[model samples]
Target: MYALENEGGIKKVKKLDQFLQDNLNDLRDRGLYNEIDPVEGPNGPVIKISGKELINLSSNNYLGLATNDHLKEIAKHAIDQYGVGAGAVRTINGTMDLHVKLEEKLAEFKGTEAAIAYQSGFNCNMAAISGVMDKNDAILSDELNHASIIDGIRLSKAKVIRYNHSDMDDLRAKAKEAAESGLYNKVMVITDGVFSMDGDLAELPEIVEIAKEFNLITYVDDAHGSGVMGKGAGTVKHFGLSKEIDFQIGTLSKAIGVVGGYVAGSKDLIDWLKVRSRPFLFSTALPPGDTAAITAAVQMIMDSTELHDQLWENGRYLKEGLLKLGFDIGKSETPITPCIIGEEKLTQQFSKRLREEGVYAKSIVFPTVPQGTGRVRNMPMATHTKEMLDQALAVYEKVGKELSIIN
Candidate 1:
C-alpha cells in the first residue's frame, strides 16, 4: 500500500493514477516494462522514428511487401470500388466479391479444396480451434505454440496437452496416450509451421505420421511461414504434406503484407467454419482494400520467388555476420534470429543500446521464454540491402561488447 505524501497534507494522491503508477513502477523495477517505439512511415527494412532512422530488425514484414508500391495501388483501387469498410459481418451482407476472391486465391495458393477468410490471423486461430474442438475434444499443442493458439485452445473448452516443443517422440507418446485414454470424442494436434521465437521449423512429417497412427486431425498455423517458406506457399508445402494435413491456417498480415487471416481445408471444413466460427458470425468482415490487397499479394508470391530468395540470403548474411562477431546467434533455420543474453535486465539494456546506435531490435525476456534465457530477436527482411545489414552488424557488435555480452 502507498501512503499519501507529506507535502499533500490535503490528500493529494489521486487513487486511480497512483494505483496505475505503482503497478507500472513495479513492472519497471522487475525489468519487464515494454518500451514502444512507433515507426513514422512504412515498415520497410529501414524505418524512421522520432527523427531518427534505424536499421530495423523488429518487424514481421518478412517479404517487404507491406510497403510494396504495387500492393498499395491495388489497395487504393479496392477502396475506390468498395470503400474502406466491409459494411457488415460475414454471416450478413459483408461477403464482398473481393472477400470471395481472396478466399478462392488462398485455397488455390495453399492447394486446399476451399478457404474462408477472417479479420486477422489471431482470429483465424481462435475461430478455427473453437469452431472445431469443444469440451468433448482434446488438443495436443506444442508448448512453444503462439499465444493466439493457447487462447484458442482455452476458448475451445477442450483438454489441452502440451508436448515438448519440436520433440517428435514426446508428441508420439502423448498422441498415443490421448488416443488410448478414449476420453475425447475427437483429438486434434495443432502446431506452428515455424516457431517464431527460435526460427526453427516444426517437424511436420513426423507429426503427420503420428496423427495418422492415432487418427487425429492435424492443424498447421502457418502465420510466420507464409510467403517465407516452400518458396512462399507455406511450411506444409515446404514439407510436401499439403494433401495430408487437415487444416492450414495463414495470415495476410505477415509475409502477405496486408491484413486478415484464413483457414484453407476441405470445402466441408471451410463451410463449417464460415457458419460456426464466432468471428464470422458476430464480428465485422475484412475491408475491401485489405481483402483485395491480400489476394494480390498472394498472387505475387505464387508468381515468383525473387523476394523469397532475397529474404533467405539476407538471413544467412545476418547470421554469419553475427556468428563471426562471436555473438551466440541461435540455431535458427529461418530469418528470425535471436542473440541470446542471459539476464532479463541485461537483455533489455542490449536492445536499448542497439536502438541508440541506429538499430531497432527488441528484447524478448521472461516469461515469454525461460526466465534466464533472455534475448534480442532480429528479423531480417528481403528488402534489406547488404549495406544495411553491415550497418546493423556493426551496431550489434558495439552494443554487445559495451554490455560485455560478446568479447
Candidate 2:
C-alpha cells in the first residue's frame, strides 16, 4: 500500500497503481501515446481543431456527406417523426420501419438478396462471423484482415489459419488443406476488401476463385470500399462477383459518411443473422436519424457516381503530389496515402509539426501498424478544393524537408 499526503492517510494499492502508471509511462516513452484532438463542429475535408482551422486528412468521411445538407434535412425529419432513441433491442420493439428501409436500401446498394444492420462495422463482423461459425468450424483469414474480423473469428471458437496478405498461392494451399482435413464441419475465407493501412485492394477475384474451388464460404469486410468502389456498390460489384461472395460486410460511417455497419448476402444468410447475430438480437437498433440518413446517402450514391468520381480524382491528385515531392508515399491503390517514415519518434514528430503547420493528419505507429513502418495516413475527400490540396502540399513539403523525410 502507498499513502498520498493529500489523501489524509488513505491507502492505495501499489500493485494496481504501478501497473497503470508503468504502461502509460512506457507508451509515452515509446512515442505510442495517442493524444486525441477534439474537432469542433462537423467533420469535413477541412475542420476546426482547438480553434485552429486545419486541412483534415484524418477522418473517414470519404464522400463529404457527413455535413451534406440533404442528409441533415433527412435526419431532422426522421428525428421529428421517430424521436431520437431506438427504445430497445432490434428483437424487442427496436425494429422500426427506418431500420427496415435501411436494410433494404443496403441490399439494393450492395446488389445482394438481403442485408442486416448492426451498431457498427466492428459489430457487424463480430455478429456475422460468430452467427455462422462455431467450435467445429475453421476460418482461413488474411494476415492483413481488419481487427474486427480477427476478433469475430476468435469469438466463434473456430480454428483460425491466417494466409499471407493477398497471396493467392498461400490462400489456395490453405483452402485445400482446410477443405480436405475432415477436421471441421465448415471453412470460411475472410479478407478486408481494402487494406486500410496500405490502401491496397484485396485480390477478390482470385479469392472468389479459391472459395469456389474449395467450396469455402467467402466473407469480405468492405468497410473501406463500400462507397469508394464500383460506383458505390462495393468490392464484390467492383469485380462483378456480387452473387459469388457469401458474406459482404460494410460500414455506413466511412465512405457513406454516416454511422453503422451491415452484412449483405443471400436471403437465407441475412435471415439467419437476423435471428442469431448477438448485436442484432441483443443491442439496441440504430437511432432513427442515422437509419434514415444512411438510407438517403446510399440512394444518392446509387443515383449517380458524381461523388465517387470526385473522390478518386482527389485521391489521384494527392498521391501524385506526395510522390512528386519525394515522400515515401506507399503503394496505395486508394485515397489512403501513407507517407511512410520508418522511425517511430520521427513519425510522431512529423505529425506534430504537420498539425502546427495547419494540417491535422495524425501519426500512426506500433500495434496499430508495425514498429518501423510508422507513417501518417492521409485521407483526402471529395470536397477538398484544388487550392486546399495545394496548401496542404506546400505545408507537407516544408515539414517533410525540415524532418529530412525528403531531400
Candidate 3:
C-alpha cells in the first residue's frame, strides 16, 4: 500500500495510484522513463535549459520559421486583430475567415481542390481515418507508421493489415489479398510520407501503383515531409504524384513552424470531412493567430526554396560529419538523423552526455522505436549555422568515443 499527502493529512493510496506507481517505477527501473527538459526561451537552433545554453537539434522546426521575425510579426498582428480565442467550436461560429483562408492556402500549397484544418496533425488523423473508415473497412498501414495513425485506425474499428516497413512486395501481396477477400467494403492504404524515427521516405510511387491495381484509397501523412521535401511542397510533390494520391495529410507545426493539421484533397472529400469529421464538427477551431500565421508560413514556403535548400545543405553536412566520425546513422533519407545506440539505458546515457557537452538531442527508446534500436534523433533546422552543426558533431564524437559507441 502507498500513502499520499493532501492539504490536511496523509491518505491511503487508491488502486489507480498503485497501478500508476507500479508502471512508473518499472519504467524508471528499466530506463524507459522519459525525462522531459523544458526550454527556457524560444525554440530555436540554440536553446536554454536549467540555465545552460545548448545547441538544439531535437526540434521539428525544419525551416526555422517558428522563430522567424516575419512569422512572429504575423502571429502578433493576428493576435491583435482576433484577440485571444475563437470563442467556440467551429460548428458554433468559430470558423472565422482566418480558418477559411488557411484551409484555402493549405489546399493551394498541397495542390488539392480543397482542405480541412484540425487542431493538430494527430487529431487530423483521428478525425480523418475514423470519419471515412469503419468496421466494414480495412486499413493497410505500414508497419512503421506513426502512433497517431495506429490510434486513428483503432478508433475507426477497421481491420488493420500492417505491411513490413518499405517492403513493396509485402505491400503488394497484402493489397492483393485484401482487395480479393471481399470481406471489407473499403480498403485504404496509409503511410507516413517520411517515417519520423528512421527519417526514410515512403515508397509512395510503388504504393500508388499497388493502390491503382487494387483500387485502394491512398493516405499519406506528410507531416515531416512537408516544408522539407519536394522543394518544400512535401513527399507527394517530391514524387510528382500529387494528383494521383487521394488524401494528403500535413502538419503546420513542423515545417510551417505554426500549429495545426490539415487534410488536402478533392472538394468533395473536404466537404464530406467538414460535415462528418468529429473533430472539425465538435472541437474548437484553431486560434485565429495560429491560422493566419500558418497561412503566411505556407506562402513563405511556396515563395522560395532558400530555406529548404539551406536545410538540406545542413542535413548533408551533419550526416556526412557523423558518418566520417564512424557513427551508425540508420537508414535515413531525410534530415532526421538517428545515432543508433542499440540499448535503452545506453541510448539515454548517450543523450545525457550530449546534453552535458552542450548539445540537446533526445534519446528515443522502445515503444517509440524498437527495444534494441534505441537512438538519439537529431533534427537539423534551416537556422542551424555551419558552426552549430560542427559543435554538435564534435560533441557527438566525444560522447561516441567515451561510450565506446564508435571506434
Candidate 4:
C-alpha cells in the first residue's frame, strides 16, 4: 500500500524509500549526513580508517579496555575453555558458569542485591524498564535521556512525561503531577546518569531526594557513568547515594571495554526481568569470552582506581587545552567533551575539516540535539598518551582558526 504524505495530499508515496531519500537529501543539503568508515586497527586514541591512521576521539572505549592486553588475555583464556557462543538464550540452556560469575561480579561492583545481564545497554533499558512497569505505570523521563530509554518506555505502554533536562524543579513538578494524576499504579523517574552528548551528569542527589519525597521508583542509566565516575562504580556511588536508587542500568561496553549491559537492583527486580524481559529470554547469552572479559574488567575497576584517575586526568588536560584555545567546550564535567558549534552545517563542516586534518571527532547535529546546538563530541580514553593528546590539540587549534570557530 502506498503511504500518503498527508491526509490532505493527493499524492501517494513509497513510504520507506521516499522517507529515506527525503531525510537523506535534507541531511546532505544541511551537511549533516555522515557515511560510516570501518576502523582498520585497534580502538586506541589513534585508529586506522580507510588505510589512514587518524587521531580518534569517536569511540566509546572510555577506559581503553577494548584493546587492553589484560582484557584480551582473559577473553582468550575463556574462549579456550568455553568455545565461543553460549548457543541459546539464558533460560533455554545458555546460562553458562561464566554468565553467573559475571553477574556476581557486576552485583558486587554496583553494590546491588543482584544483577541481570542483557545483550546490550540498549536492550538492558528495553528489558529492565519494560519488565518492571507496563501499561498501568507512568514514566517521568528526562528530556535528554538516551534514545534507548525513550524506545523502551514506549514499548512498555506507560504514560511518559518528560521533564526538562537535569532540571530538578521540573522533575519534582512532573513527579508530583504524575503521582497525583492517580491514573497509574506505579510512577518512575528515569534519567541517564551521565548524558552522553552533553557530558554533563544527572542531578542524582536531587533526583534521589525527589524520589524519596514522592515515593517514586528511581532508574539511572549509567552507560557513560559506570567506568568514569565514583571510583569506577557509577554516579550513584559517586554521590554516595547508591542505596536510594532502585534500578541501576550500566553497560559493559564503554568503560568495561566489552559488550553487554546489566540491571542491578533488588533480587526481586532481577528475578522479574529473567522471566519477563523478552531480550533475556529470547536472545542468545553473552559468549564466554565476553562474559569473562567483563568480569576481569569489573574486578580491575574495583581493585584500584588507576584507570579512572588516568581517564579524568586525560579529560581535564584536553578540556583545559581546548578551552585555552578559545573554543566553547560546553559545560562538561566528565571526559565526554563537546565542542559546541551553534549551527548544524558549521558543526558538520568543522568535523569534516578536523577529520581531514587528522582528528576523528564525529559531529552531532539537528535532531540528535536541538536545532542549533550541534557539536563535535570528543571522548578521551584513559590510555591516551600526552603526545597523542598534544598532537590532537594542535590539529584542533589549527582547524578551529581556519573554520573561524576560535580566534
> Candidate 4: what lDDT?
0.92
**Tens-digit lDDT track for model 4 on 142-195?**
999999999999999999899999998898988998888889899999999999
Q: On a 0 to 1 TM-score scale, where does candidate 2 land against the true structure?
A: 0.97
Candidate 2: stretches off by over 4 Å: 1-12
TM-score of each: 0.95, 0.97, 0.97, 0.95
User: Mind giving the per-residue lDDT tens digits that candidate 1 earns over 285-395?
Assistant: 999998888999999999999999999999999999999999887779989999989789999999989999999999998778887888999999999999999999999
**Candidate 2 per-residue lDDT over residues 232-273, each given as its tens digit:** 888778999998899999999998888999999999999999
* Best model per lDDT: 3
Clashing residue pairs in candidate 3 are: none
- How high is the lDDT of residue 78 in model 4? 93
Worst 10 residues of 3 by lDDT: 1-10
- The ten-residue window of minimal lDDT in model 1 covers 1-10
Candidate 1 matches the true fold with a TM-score of 0.95
Question: Per-residue lDDT for 197-278 in model 3, tens only?
Answer: 9899999999999999999999999999999999999999999999998999999899999898999999999999989999
